[model samples]
Target: MKQIFAFMPTFLLSVIFCNAQKLTATDVNSPEVTVVVDIKVNPQFKSEVKSLVPELSALTIKEAGALSYNYYLSPDGNKILIIEQYKSLSAFQEHGKNLFSGPLGQKFRSSFTVNSIVVAGGNLPDSVGNFTVMKSIGGFNSKCE
Candidate 1:
């Protein structure tokens, strides 16, 4: 009983220190940044919009800096979630150029009722808003076979 209480404080301290140290050490080195987009489309547009996911992803992945671009449909079928990863800030910026200014991106915009974006990374882009940024902890990103 006494030993358990004594170890609790030590355990907590270790956990805090380990997490802090880990965040400090590698957060800057984590160059991969991601954009998560949540889209709610008018029901009439749902089927048409869903069909375009592969097209968008395919074009995005062909770019030099895109690590991955995937879109998922919510079970209820009204919402779409797009997860896009890039190798660096510059890559993300390059994506931003197409996202608003290009024809394919216009198609993406025309499909959704509401499009909310959240950028997550060690460093957030200054030009974008509405982000849920975070320091990297630890994880591995592997390509799907």
Candidate 2:
């Protein structure tokens, strides 16, 4: 109806304004940090990669200060995206140290090739090596119950 169409723009504008406020109100200094890792599983190691995922996720989720550790596999199953969130930057650094040192790390390295790593939120203490870092300007992260 004409009446519904006339009110649609106002409704949309209000929604946009509310979203803008949420972004602008975000705390850039929040200590939480999230890392997204993109990797391609080697053809020969596809089965190995699949097997390693559960073990790796279990260990990671048990680590201190780990907020969440999740992996997403592409439809073709050749690529994987890992999303990890930490309570703080220190926690993230500790996880990296642990991950790059042991037998698990070696097995992981042999299974997949890291294509890219993107870090978001918090101030990084040192360079992330080959990673692309993104600072939070305006955004919000929802906490799930």
Q: CA lDDT of each candidate? A: 0.73, 0.82
RMSD of 1: 10.7
| True-vs-predicted CA distance for residue 95, candidate 2, Å | 0.7
Deviating ranges (above 4 Å) for candidate 1: 1-28, 125-127, 137-145
How do the residues 28-126 of candidate 2 rate in per-residue lDDT, one tens digit apiece?
788888899999998989877778998787768778889999899997989999999998878888888888787888888999999999888856644
By TM-score, who's the top model here?
2
Candidate 2, residue 132: the lDDT equals 84
Clashing pairs in 2: none
Query: Please, what are the lDDT tens digits per residue for candidate 1 over residues 1-145?
Result: 9889989998887767664432223454577788888889777677787678767777777779998888888878889888888988679779878666878777766788656777777665455555555555555542212
Go through the candidates in order and give the clash count of each: 0, 0
The TM-score measured for candidate 2 stands at 0.76
Question: How does each model score on TM-score?
Answer: 0.67, 0.76
What is the TM-score of candidate 1? 0.67
